[model samples]
Target: MSKSAIFTGLVIFIIIALFPFWINFGKTAPVPEPELVGKAKTAKKCVLDKMDMRANHMSLLDEWRDSVVRDANRIYTNTDGKEFAMSLSTGENSCLGCHEDKSKFCDKCHNYASVDPYCWECHTEPKEIK
Candidate 1:
């Protein structure tokens, strides 16, 4: 009887402790999907596969930074055997080259994920997010 009472008490305590959480469950904002526009759309290609990019973009960028700055390697070969400049410059083939509209293309998903990547600190936000 004591064991049963203790288990019941524990269960009640747990429910009470989590009641606030339960009340707000499933109330989060829906996941945001960033859309490509302008050059990003017409290119019909990305540095990696969509799923892979979505999961590992930060890792890929970190690797690119190290390679470009430390090793002076600026060529990135994608899994599809395509080569691209590992640059964040505003050239016609760089990161900002394609993703011209940071607000729509990058910020949507980044904001939804609550991340503030430092990419901007070095590369600078687009002068006009064009």
Candidate 2:
């Protein structure tokens, strides 16, 4: 083949190989962010304050439990990513349902292994309120 013909063929091959990536790049629809309505922050604070005032550890952590449940339900429904590979706890229970009673459940494994969980980073501690 002539030199110009060979060059044109190579250029066409390269474009064809890269076409799929270029076609998919930034092609997804943009996700809409949640709109913050009036008094949303204040309403959340008031609800959390009421939970804190209830004097029960469970009530204090109820917000975190609800958040986890909602996230799990979303994952279960979507099943679009790797979430479909793992198991989710769907029952009406929180991680506290297992971790709080250390002597009974958590201690049996986590205590013996001397491992600390990152859960408390966001979730409330089950111990007496500090």
Writing each residue's lDDT as its tens digit, candidate 2 over 26-125 gives 8874533323233432233222243453345344345445654666533222222222211212222233322333345433544445656554565454
> Candidate 2 — which residues are off by over 4 angstroms?
1-92, 98-100
Whole-structure CA lDDT of model 1: 0.84
Best by lDDT: 1
Show model 1 residue runs off by greater than 4 Å: 1-28
Each model's lDDT comes to: 0.84, 0.43
Query: After TM-score superposition, what is the CA distance of residue 130 in candidate 2 from its true location, in Å?
Result: 8.5
User: Tell me, what's the RMSD of every candidate?
Assistant: 4.5, 19.3
lDDT of 1 by residue, 1-130 (tens): 6999999999999999999899989897677778888888888878998788889988998999999899999898888898889987656778878887788888998897789988887687565544
Which TM-score value belongs to model 2?
A: 0.25
